[model samples]
Target: MGTQERLDPQAGVGTRVREPWVTVVWNDPVNLMSYVTRVFQEYFGLARHEAEARMREVHEKGRSVLSSGSREQMEIHVQAMHGYGLWATLERSDG
Candidate 1:
């Protein structure tokens, strides 16, 4: 067998369990654009322009990844979004 065909026992050794997550904000007619922008700014501490940008992305694209991190962090973000009365959900990131 060629060297490339050999299995490396240490290939995945000691690798951290990275649990990627996605924060999805669904389209809801009830929330106002300004309110959404405020929520993004308040909850995530995003700058005014950045917050509005994400809000616009969500409004235009039907959804946006407000933030991404570990599962625990995502859960926190999801709950925070809920606290702001915005439609939000978390899912495993494909990456």
Candidate 2:
């Protein structure tokens, strides 16, 4: 199966549905786990437990999906993460 396409009523043309984009934070050697968790909490407004879980995922799995939304929002998130000294990237969601 594949993603569904939709017709834009106004434009009267077919367009692929917009897929959500995700901001991914990658593990790095420089930042401490505690710091990463704190950043996740502060920037993403995530609960303490949730932030800690994501931090652990980045530590063990090499990366973690921090947020999912429009591509522009994900870009903003990636930029914020860079400002905070965390490695991050954005990509289309698999779903």
- Give the top-scoring candidate (lDDT): 2
Score residue 69 of candidate 2 by CA lDDT.
72
Clash number for every model?
A: 0, 0
Model 2 segments more than 4 A misplaced:
1-16
lDDT of 1 by residue, 11-88 (tens): 944444446687898779999999999988988899999999999998999998987877778888899888889999
What is the per-residue lDDT of model 2 for residues 22-86, given as tens digits with 9 covering 90 to 100?
99999999999999999999999999999999999999999999888778788999999999999
* TM-score per candidate: 0.82, 0.83
80 Cα displacement, candidate 1 (Å): 1.1
lDDT of 1 at 85: 91
Q: List the residue pairs that clash in candidate 1.
A: none
**Model 2 steric clash pairs:** none
